[model samples]
Target: MEQKEKQILVSIISSIVILASYSLYVYHKFMAGNPGIINDFRFWGRAFLILIPVAIMAQIIIHIIFAIIHKIVTDEDLSTKNDERDKLIELKSIRISHWLFTLGFFLSMGSQAFGKPPWVMFITLICSGFIASIASEGAKIFFYRKGL
Candidate 1:
């Protein structure tokens, strides 16, 4: 697999895993009646901050591991350079992702307006964004395999 595709795969998978794990943990806390997790704005704010880094680090580590394994298997270094087609694929993916985000944002806002709690709003926003990103990455991988 190409380096970019590998990176995208790692990023999407890692982000999903991290988000799911965090959500499950918070849900458990909510069920246990732990204060400031599912109902508190402050808790969500802190959780968001923590989640960002954990997701980012997971991507970085996964990407590195994939690179090392790819090198060992292929006996060649993964190229860091991107070509024109790569840039075009990225742009197209981002364009689609933008639409996804806009749609998701509106949905999130609608949920907020419908009197959902803070935690619900938080999950809606985060999940929409994550879905958008995953969709974009999936598009990139598809385009890469499809070629120019």
Candidate 2:
């Protein structure tokens, strides 16, 4: 596999690990103790707010660790610069991610419109975000492999 594909694969794995562990933590730490908190707007808001920074920081740390391990294993530094093709691939994947997330956002609102509980909307949003991230990374890998 090329470096870009490997990097994207690592990103996908890291995202899955971060989201799964975080969701489990939240379920046990708060939701399991008080199931009623699921409908609480404040609880959802706090979770979203906390998750953003946590996800960003975790991604950074995970990527740094990946870079170090990759270096030690291959004795090669991952490319840090993006040329035209790289830029195009990034832009295309980002467009895909944007559209998926936008669809998810509308679906979340639709859940509320249908009289679903607030937790449903929150869960939908979270799922959409996670799916979008994975899809974007997967798109990048595909594009790289296809020589696009």
Which predicted model would earn the best TM-score? 2
In order of appearance, the predictions have TM-scores of 0.85, 0.97
Question: Mind giving the per-residue lDDT tens digits that candidate 1 earns over 14-104?
Answer: 7788788877876686546665546767777887898888878877887788889988988888788888988999999999889988987
Candidate 1 achieves a global lDDT of 0.82
Candidate 2 local lDDT, 34-82, one digit each (tens): 9899889999999999999999999999999999999999999999989
Instruction: Please give the lDDT score at residue 8 for candidate 1.
Output: 83
Give the per-residue Cα lDDT of candidate 2 at 133. Answer: 94
Relative to the unseen true structure, what is the C-alpha lDDT of residue 133 in candidate 1, on a scale of 0 to 100? 90
Candidate 1 local lDDT, residue 49 = 91
Number of the top-ranking candidate, with lDDT as the measure: 2
Q: Give Cα-based local distance difference scores for all models.
A: 0.82, 0.94
